[model samples]
Target: MIALAMVDNFPSSPGIYLMKSAEGSILYIGKARNLKKRVRQYVLGSGDSRLHIRFMVQLVESVEYIVTDTEKEALILENTLIKQHHPKYNINLRDDKTYFSLRMDMKEPYPRLTLVRKVPSDGARYFGPYASATSAKEVLKQLYKVFPLRHYPLATCMARKRPCLYYQIKQCSAPCCGKITAAEYATLAEGAALFLEGKNTEIARIYRAKMNLASQDMRYEDAARYRDLLRAIEVTVERQKMVARGGDSDVFGLYRQGDQVQMAVLHVRGGALTGSRTFLFDWEMETEEGLASFLNEYYDMDTPIPPQILTPLPIPEPAALEELLSEKSGRKVTIAVPQRGPKLEMVKLAEKNAQTAAEERLAKESSSATLLSELADKLHLPAPPRRIECYDISNIQGEMAVGSRVVFIEGKADKSLYRRYRIKGVLQSDDFAMMREVLSRRFRAESDEEKPDLIVVDGGLGQLSVLNAVLEELEVEGVEAAGLAKSRTFRDMESPEISKSDERVFRPGRKNAISLRQNSAPLLLLARIRDEAHRFAVTYHKAVRSKVMVTSELEGVPGIAGKRKKALLVHFGSLKAVKEATVEQLSAAPGMTAKAAKALWEHLHEKQQA
Candidate 1:
């Protein structure tokens, strides 16, 4: 539904549009203060009335735009084109274990707090968007029960000579034995940034004026350690949930059943509710532009931005996304929409916890679509593979061979379509020519990846006849493979019993092996995709046998050949970091040469001067 003479020469300023689809792809990405009155509100459909944007504006076909000289540079180029074109009708929010936070680095000397997950522009103070990594290590285990701070790192507590069981329990101020003072660990890192900025009554009135100045200097054990730091800051602010009596907000909650969306937020902070999260997904558009592109990718500067934001719906350019979340959460943020009291009953308890997190994620995606249709009816296959892929291989008898693969989709594990390979022209212990050179270099690669709808292979019936001779020598058709095996045991020689066997499977024209039933959910999902492709090929064949034992000590040194022995094992990633480097870090590695890094640093210290 594009052509209104293709947005009649667009430019009514502000920008970022995109739409596309009909071969060109990007089916949605938005942002605009005007771009010709928002592509004339989705080409006269008045922008978004959602039937998921009128079936994505009848498959768009073209709308492009860009412009950007402010509407906050078209809200950061529509969040960098919805994170580089993940634009399938917007709202991804897939990244999970929600932004951890906490950090501290007030130019260090003794400042700790820690927990992270990306928040670096390093001036450092941070706090949290925390709702995981066990709520930012349960708020750094209650800010180490009253901020004595320094829980390690000042170069590992200045290589600690002593003082660690968190300074024998007063939860650390050992500052590695100097027991505090860097202005008392910078006043316990300003009372752990005012108890993670919920400002627990100005840090319990500065620990009640340091427990009444350590009880007027009589110092009864520093006035009972400031009366146990105001009773552990009033028992962690009496375990949260107040929901009011103060401010720092963040409510937002919307739920949808069609186009499956969820949303939820809650948080509240000083006014308490303390945590809620929810996001769920499948959105197609207009819940005020998916809660305004989820509050501009959930307030990015690694998340925590609550001066206020309580939406139910008002979005589009809400004052230029409150000036881009008040310039990346430095503060003054607001987005409200209330309409009654108790902030619309905490946005209807974040839309009843986003409709109980979208009916517990559609009953865990309808029990992973009935365990992928009972594993496509016990692997007779045709449909429920829902992108499987497995492989395996590893190597020790073959010396550093590799393999791996892994993936699984509808029934879960998708380590970003895992993969691995490396057995270069099978030189030895042939596990069927190293599983036919890792399944013919993963089905003769011309990669954009996504192909598998089932391929698993670990072993049995000679690894399903080397994956049916590498998919009948890569004429590779719609995939479907199987092999599995593992479960052996035996032992009975008269009264000393043992016996084991059940795992099996096999398939490709099955000449046997099918067993199953020992704890079957399709044999525990084909033994969890053959033990995650044998733990991703024995963690990449123990990192290629420790870089082939550091390329056999750079093939007995001299000029250290093979491209400076693979550029000093890819720049010193061990032979004990190239035998503790330095012949000027092996002549600054990459294909070395200060006379071959002083003959491989004098042949790696000539076997430590024998």
Candidate 2:
């Protein structure tokens, strides 16, 4: 039936409504505190300007709604219908339906901790739809550290001769090795569930009690370990402080303009901000109208129902929506318009962040446009260079010295193409020698897989000279090159001050240099490329240095092979922790046995004797 006709038929009672497009696919799903009053707003036309609704009013092929006993029931039904239908105009809960959830399958003999992207129906407890894959893994890492719950697959847990790598890393308690009882593991799993469900206060109390018991039992070290876990939990909660308001309330803020719109959502549970997400959408409609349309569409999503939602605008069906949302949440939901208070402050903060995000995106676009225009003019090229490459060298007393290449497409940095080189044949911190060695090896291996139109070096006259010599020897041509130099210091007090902001550009075979005005487009472009190159180089150097600092028995102690390393790690958990462990403790580790642990301890102790 037509939308207006269906609206005429709607009863003045709680119900779930469905808006559909011409193709018989649902477009929007919503619950109304009063079906007749909510539906009448569409049919009677309260001078609403939403283009989507206007079109629907003109050609709404069909409309449907299900009556519910209460607004809460309608809310539940609306979310379910929205998930099932996935209408075109709905504010999607999970943008990429392929989302991740931390699953704890409590049904198994040895419960498993697995990462699942899709929800399953196998009676597993699921925890999240984390924003990104990396974020999901980060949560998993924190969960493991907090709980040390086993992550072994069902089959592996059933028939395991030894603990796996996770056990060696101390990330798991080795339940497969029978080191921990099933009942104790189950308790940990239950605690994890409560933690995920926003029950931190209860968990904190329990943890404190356990810590006290361990202390009373003369296990001072174990008590300290519990203290560390408590600190981690506090840090996690504090990191999420921005979203939480110490109350069970939802926050929604939007930044929108005619065709572009972004929404920020904060879900506060048990007085803690547990989740926050941002959503962006493009609608071929006006701004205010789009806000109204989006507001209606968003609340219909099938995520957990919050008791209250704070929004910037008064929605079209405010009373009906409040009632419907309240009913769905199984409580009285107050959809308040905060004039001034902490609530208002939160709303303003969200709006400001959203606006800032939008502005940054626009600024980057403008920067890219300017760079493309300037590069085309300066390089004497037919068009702007699409890809630019810059290089820098990093070292500490010539040990673990490395070179890095950073790429910029148009004007923005592209990290995926960043490459690092280990400096060979360069004995010390000689910038010139390092440049020659790094560049020669780089271009020598160029193929269909790698090449750039422009190359930049983070140096001055000497460094560029070395690079030019390498290019000439290699006979590589048609590529433009430049050197960016930092400002030099002056001795004379009366002379104009030399600022770090001052940068000089050097060109090949040129007598004079180019100096971009501190605030000019070219200066900004060059500085951006230089900073990115420095960042890339420093990151690579740190990685190499960290590896050098890490003392591994296999690499350090003689006669320690693959099997021994595995045994040490699996027995002692972590190398650093193992270093601090007593000889008795090390030997007691499962397969290590007393004799082997004693021998290892004596070998390590020989250093003190020397």
Give the lDDT of residue 307 in candidate 2: 67
Which pairs clash in the backbone of model 1?
41-47
**Candidate 1 lDDT, tens digit per residue, 279-307?**
76777666677778877877753667777
Per-residue lDDT over 1-610 for candidate 2, one digit per residue giving the tens place of the 0 to 100 score: 3546656777888887776667777766666777778667766766456676677555556678889987656656766776677666554454533445678878877666677766544667776645567887887788888878877554334345678788888778788788778876786777787777677888788778879999999989768977887887777767764444555676778887655787777666666655567767765434544554555456554344556777776654466557665655466877766778878877787787677777777787787887777865764445666778899999998888999988988777787788899998988878678878888878884555456677889988777788788888988776678888877765556767653446788878775567566667766787789988998899999988876664444365544556776766665555654565677666665566676666677766675467
TM-scores for all predictions: 0.33, 0.49
Model 2, residue 375: distance off in Å is 12
lDDT of each: 0.77, 0.71
Q: CA lDDT of 548 in candidate 2? A: 63
Where is the poorest 10-residue window by lDDT in model 2? 90-99
Candidate whose TM-score is highest: 2
**lDDT, candidate 1, residue 175?**
69
Candidate 2 has which clashing residue pairs, if any? 72-327, 72-328, 244-273
